[model samples]
Target chain A: MLSPLLSSSIKYYLCFMQTVIIGSGNVAYHLAKAFVLNRIPLAQIFGRNENELSKISGELNIPYSTETLQKADLYIICVSDHSVEDVSGTITTKDCLVAHTSGSLPKEILKGDYRKASFYPLQTFSKSKALDYSKIPFFIEAENEEDRKILFEIASKISDNVMESTHEKRKYIHLTAVFACNFVNHLFARAKEISDLQVIPFDYFLPLIDETVQKIHEIDPKSAQTGPAVRNDTRVLQLHEQLLQGESLEIYKTMNLSIKKMYQLP
Target chain B: MLSPLLSSSIKYYLCFMQTVIIGSGNVAYHLAKAFVLNRIPLAQIFGRNENELSKISGELNIPYSTETLQKADLYIICVSDHSVEDVSGTITTKDCLVAHTSGSLPKEILKGDYRKASFYPLQTFSKSKALDYSKIPFFIEAENEEDRKILFEIASKISDNVMESTHEKRKYIHLTAVFACNFVNHLFARAKEISDLQVIPFDYFLPLIDETVQKIHEIDPKSAQTGPAVRNDTRVLQLHEQLLQGESLEIYKTMNLSIKKMYQLP
Candidate 1:
């Protein structure tokens, strides 16, 4: 039966928001889980890795497609930043609103015969770690109004935190995240290594680490910053430098200088 | 009327454990505040700066001692790293416990006619921030069994998270904390600046920061690492390097190499 809205666009409109998530990494895993947890089921998952795709699909009870991009209302390519272009090029559907979940890449990368958009979740995703979707900021950018509205609706259903972040700003956030998340984690890794070398259990650091994060909850990062570098405590700083070696020493000195410069310490 | 314990030896014994916290810095402020809040009043506060000491003393209604370390059971010198020895030297009691709240300093620094100890709280403190004393890990070290027992009892009363850590191990933890707390906070400061320069608000990095800390709540830092450096994505690494400069660029390269070396990536 043909409805009043039935036209050449009827098929595309019917497929509009039904999603097919591509890739099976951290983002894809969590996003797929979020869809199911929110009762917004994914239509299929397209990925080249059979082992991972099969495991993910089997767990979610969604069909897995490895051959090509399946027909759906939306195709979310969750590949690495470098592969976003290549992966998006393969999904050539004029009707579907195609999006890649990358903070660094511009939405234009997904522009093709199909609709273009970005569905970046501005949070770290680890496979084993559980996270509340409602707290995760979902940054959506679409090629057009219709696609934007659809993406917004989908994102809103999945997470309470929805923002229409532009490509340019998201890129900046991505860079900052490298410092806040990635680089900070590197620091923690180094801390563990240092503690291990000194024959102290890593558990001694948990409270300090927790307090460091908890400090920023009430104060700005600048005001919350404290250490020998901030205090310009040359005695303690030199003693620490003497204890470290190689890359650890380099990072210690580099970060020390960075903190000194930040605080305008001599 | 005089009791049997009121003799000359008894006089000094009664003074033991009654604390006079020295200095009014962040550590001293929080420790004094904690003691007050916990209904355990500090006997006095000795500060070279009368203005700061008066303010804190008036707030807590504790006596402010500027002339010298007032006779007390415990004199906790919560001064700077370089001043621990000097501060400890001022207290020339024969039997009272004299401790410094310095993580880097050895208990020997407080060695004198008085009993030596360390009452280091292993957490970052800021005047503007409020923290639950129970969560702060107090690392206590003492010269004798009686002093150790007293310090443990006091620390336990203030914080459930108390440990009898040695000077050597505590020093190692302090070094690790420079990487975990101080250095990471420095990274957050840098992230905020980079984000500001790019015209992005610092709030965008908060969620990322929270998640970075949250990730470690469940897993080890090494297992939780996710970024270009861990993935060894040289393309994105170079792109990010291009956007950074000076100390930021140096930190980027230093941290990148550190991560690579840690992961043993080519």
Candidate 2:
């Protein structure tokens, strides 16, 4: 409700606070859904790709624009790492606090004549598969305390596991995430490939993979580590190497050596 | 619940329908616990080391044996992979079925005039942590139909997910487990090392790790894979490699290359 005494512009700002999400990739799509799911005043979603944009627009039943300029109190630039700066630049949002959803990019990349921050959800999100947003750890960053609070407040609304991180600390989160999420998934992929070759369904490794992750939840992965390299089982290691060739062979050897050195195996 | 037999020899076999588990290691300890938990007749546990063996004996309230030959209908050799042959050799249980719990080793390894078999549980068992044996896949194999049925009956009693796996298939499962469990855990370990160096606790990677494992349950890992390497983002890949050094760098580079090659990225 707008008060008669209040200025029209001030009343407009007070009456409605809206968010415009940029991009339509996995992170963008999931974030958009989560924002809507939480009723976070999501006004518009902008996607460069017409097909993907329409897909998101239809799914969320929200107004979307391919136009660079969209009016919203908060503009979340959720695009690829390379295009984050470009997306921020294209958003002609003024006075609004703009943030990019990137784990690696610094907050400064959000280039607009407005306050900026990086609103990074530290999790691997797939668009179709809905993630538990409340469980997702969010790393928010901004220069000013006021703007930071605004970002933090909005982020906290979505996730209980929210915290302010410096660009330095947040970037390490990105690098480490690559190892944990990306590299770990690759290991699963390689392992799956190996199983597929042997006419084994990928399901054979599910229990083992679940336990591997579950261990870190209870104990440090360092002590939870086990296998040929840790046990110094050169015979089995040789047998495994015999099955792997080319790139996988190199990976097995390299990781084996690392594991051996990490544990200082005999 | 045994009916009286006319002869002492028939009564000896009928009265002692029990299992003797050899070795007090992770697999043995967990198997012993699971057996009792399921109300299976686990009569004795044997370990070369008196200290560890006594710990298991006292905990399970089962008789501890230093002697290799403990009377039971079945003998399960649950020693290390390398020690399976030697452990099976030491067991002198005639007529009773002797099964070594090893994914890689064949049932023939068990020496003496005993019906040989393999009863491998496909999981990472830690003695301190009790696993849900019902969910763990139990792989069984035996020399003869009678011995096989005995192994199957016992394995099925503890686990619903029981299957017959030949030595050939079991070895492949063992190899794949190394890739999925051992290699995946090392990635977590390395990620933890990176986080530790930067004074960041390993909690941040927890959600991502959980999701990575979760994704495989819903979708195939090869299709479920996401990251800079799969996306062919050279920029972020280069950045990740730059942050990593020594063995970590090699691991990053090798994995990145494998992911790229696996996806047939340029």
Candidate 3:
């Protein structure tokens, strides 16, 4: 038994782990491309969208189909949060490792008697954009030790940043991402709206936006905080409040209040 | 008359523009350093803080004094927004071009007969951090065309991004920056707060944060947005909401609502 397990593990590591990617979205496309680029042989790409699946299939030179799914060493379900469970149920390969690439969902959400796991890459993905996979952080979770090691080793091939994170921790991770990435982008959109009102070209604010992100890399965000809210400059804050209306005003007020509260400023 | 003016302008450009920087703060230190780096001569560094003034003087090989401010072709009031008018009153040089480095305040606020102008560099500055000045946007405003040209030329020496903006436009620019830089940093702070609660290392989120900012450079932030709020995934949103409290909860809900409103998602 030990000889057979060791032999298979060695073979998996030596050449490439046979993998099948489910769903044809941003995450699916990017992950498939990364695997191929790293010389990891994908057995097939399975998804409901024929057009998207074909694009991934052609781009990565892998077989893809909408109908039948193939058995592989691992199956990565890269569907939406709502569809992760349903997609995970379609994989019929018993005892095979099945992982869902979700930041919020737990490994238990993947139905089946198979070894369940999560191989979450912590970055926003767009189908058209290429990314440096090596820099992206991949959070891995598995029910058992051996599967965890397997997932870790595979993730390590594409990323320098990989770690074992539990579902509880990952929920917070996803929450933080919403605040840092999603909410941050919303603020950018709001800034663009305000700039549009004044006919100030949105490009003018890009440098400041870039610098804001750049600053936090070297310093903590709390320490990196600036502007009227942090400074408690009532005059400037009031002036800004007057210029905005409706949802913009509400956002401006709420954000300012939050900032002030964070720093314990009056 | 044109020859004299042209000769003086040529001389000003050839050697260096004699400039005095008032108020030794982040803006003062950065602007002063940028001027010296671009070979623009600093006549004096004047401010109330002897330690900061001396540091700038010693580092830049320029004179420093809290006692008397010197006369120069241009006197830049790099004081805080509240102190700009007061600092402008101290510069005794009549008819010399006077400028304040302020984003929100108008050029007319420089309370003197001297040619009033605003030389606002749209970036968040830290005393210890070195920045690429060429990437920073300098918004120039002046009472006269010649002064505007002078400010533009001076700004162009250190930065490639320079624009002539009115007081009206600068106010909105400043307001938009509050959303883009200041508010964005606050969100990062809040994200860090949530991540800390779960003992998830903040560094893990840095890649996601960096990618979020990088994505916006290529696509609009509206298009770049992702997460539960954008997707309107009620399950994940509710789960995240349950974990946060107080200002964090308030921020999460408000930001999500704003995003939903922006995208017109239910």
Against the unseen true structure, what C-alpha lDDT does each candidate score? 0.83, 0.82, 0.87
Docking class of 2: medium
Q: Clashing pairs in model 1? A: A15-A73, B15-B73, B16-B73, B17-B73
Number of clashes found in candidate 2:
0
Q: Comparing candidate 2 with candidate 3, which one achieves the higher TM-score?
A: 3
Which residue runs does candidate 3 get wrong by more than 4 Å? A1-17, B1-17
Q: Which tens-of-lDDT digit does each residue in B199-236 have in candidate 1? A: 77777667778888888877899999998899898877
Error of 2 at B38 (Å): 0.9
Candidate 2 local lDDT, A11-45, one digit each (tens): 34533788788888898888888877877767888
Model 3 accuracy (lDDT, Cα): 0.87
TM-score of chain B in each prediction: 0.92, 0.92, 0.95
Error of 2 at A71 (Å): 2.4
lDDT by residue (A1-266, candidate 1, tens digit) is 23444433443453445789999899999999898888776889998888989999988898997896677778888989888888888876777778899878888876468878889998889989888887787888886666776677678878877888898778777888899999999898889898888787777677778888878777888988888888899988988887889999999999999888877888
lDDT of 1: 0.83
Angstrom error of the Cα, residue B180, model 3: value is 1.2
Clashing pairs in 2: none
Question: What TM-score would every model get versus the actual structure?
Answer: 0.92, 0.93, 0.95
Best by DockQ: 3
- Which candidate gets the maximum TM-score versus the true structure? 3
Q: Worst 10-residue stretch by lDDT in candidate 3 chain B?
A: B1-10
